[model samples]
Target: MTDGQLQQLVSQISLHDFKRPFRHRAYFNARLRTTGGRYQLESHNIDINPKMLTDFDEKTLVGVIKHELCHYHLHLTQRGYQHRDADFKRLLAQVGGSRYAPTPKKQTRLAYRYTYQCQRCGLVYHRKRRLDTQRYTCGRCRGPIKPV
Candidate 1:
C-alpha cells in the first residue's frame, strides 16, 4: 500500500485501539530488514516493512501496526516505551500486538557451496568456499577430511 494509505490505516488503528491520534507519517520502508515495523523516537514516524503484506496478510500487518503504535503513543506520552518496560508490555498485551516481527526470507541464495566430511569419524562441515581437504583434518579424531 502507499504511504498515504498506511498513514490512514495507522491513524484509524490508533483511534480504534489506543484512543489516540497518530499525527506523524506512516509508510512502507523497503529498506527495513527483519523488522515488520519501526517507530522512530525522534521523528515519531512509523515505518512498515512492505514484506509484511507480500509475505503474510492483513492480520499480520495490523498486528505490526498495533505494535508500533504502542511504541509511538507510549513514547509521545512520556511513558515507559521500551520493550522491557512494564507499561509497554502491559499495553502491548492488552492490544494483542505481535511480540516480534516475522523473519524476512532471504532474497539472495545462500553462499555456502561446499561440504566436507571426516572420512573416519563421519563428522560433516559446511563451508562457503572450497576447503583444502588435504591440509585440514577433523579435530575430533585427527582423521583425514574429504569433500562430500
Candidate 2:
C-alpha cells in the first residue's frame, strides 16, 4: 500500500480501536529489517516495514498496524508504551494486537568457518566453528577426519 493508504489505515484503526484520532504520519520504511513496524517517540510518526504487506496478507498487516498503534496511542496519552510495560500489554491485548512483530527474511548469506571430510567414507561436513579432527571421527564408518 502507499503512504497515503497507510496513513488512512492508521487513522481508521486508531479511531476504531482506541477511540482517538491519529494525527501523525504513517509510511512504509524499506530499511526496517526485523521489525514489522516502529512508532517514533520523537516524531510520533509510525514506520511500517513494507515487507509486512508484501510477504504477508491483509490480516497480518492489520495486526502489525494494531501493534504499532498500541505504541502510538500509549505514548501519546503519556502511558506505558514500551513492550515490557503493563499498560502496553493490557492495551495490546484489548486491541487484539500482535504480541511480537514478525521478523523479516534475511537477505544476507551466512559464513561457514570450518569444513571436514571423512578420509575413509569420503563424507563431508560444514561447520561454523572448528572441531578437533584428531578426536572426532566419521559416525557412519568410523573413518579418520580431515579438514577440507
Candidate 3:
C-alpha cells in the first residue's frame, strides 16, 4: 500500500480500537531493517517498515499499526509507553497488537565451489573462491595445497 493508505489505516485503527484520533503522519520507511514500525516521540509520527506488507499479509500490517499506535497514544497521554510497563502491556493486549514482528528471511547462499588438500598434513579446506597455492598454505603443517 501507499503512504496515503497507510496514514488512513493508522488513523482508522487508532479511532476504532483506542478511541483516540491520530493526528500525526504515518508513512512507509524502507530503511527500517529489523523493526516492523517505529513511533517518534518528538513528532508523534509513525514509521512503518514496507516489508510488513510486502513480506507478510494485511493482518500482520494491521497488528504492526496497532503496536505502534499503542506507543503513540500512551506517550501522548503521559502514561507508561514502554514495552515493560503495565499500562503499555494492558493497552497492547486490549488492542490485540503483536508483541513482535516476524523477521524476514535472508537470501544468503552457502556455495562451496573449491576444495584444497594439504601436501604434507592432508588437511582439507572448502572455499567459495579460488586461493593462490603459492601464497597460501595449510595451518596444521604449513604445507602447500592444491585444488581438488
Each prediction's RMSD to truth: 6.5, 6.5, 4.9
Better of 2 and 3 by lDDT: 3
For residues 1-148, write the lDDT of model 3, one tens digit per residue.
7999999999999999999899999999988988999999989999999988988999999999999999999999999999999999999999999999888655476788899999898999999988999999998989889998
lDDT of 2 by residue, 54-134 (tens): 888888889999999999989988999999999999999999999977777777766887889999989998899999988
Candidate 1 ranges with C-alpha deviation above 4 Å: 110-148
**Which stretches of model 3 miss by more than 4 angstroms?**
107-148
Ranking by lDDT: 3, 1, 2
- What lDDT score belongs to each candidate, Candidate 1 first? 0.92, 0.91, 0.93
Candidate 1 clashing pairs, residues 3+ apart or interchain: none
Report the number of backbone clashes for model 2.
0
Q: What lDDT is obtained when candidate 1 is compared to the true structure?
A: 0.92
TM-score of every prediction relative to native: 0.73, 0.71, 0.73
Error of 2 at 47 (Å): 0.1
The 10-residue segment of model 3 with minimum total lDDT is: 102-111
Which stretches in model 2 have alpha-carbon errors above 4 Å?
108-148
lDDT tens digits, residues 1-148, model 1?
Answer: 8888888999999999999888889999999987899899889989999999899989999999999999999998899999999999999999999988888776997668898999999999989999888888998999999989
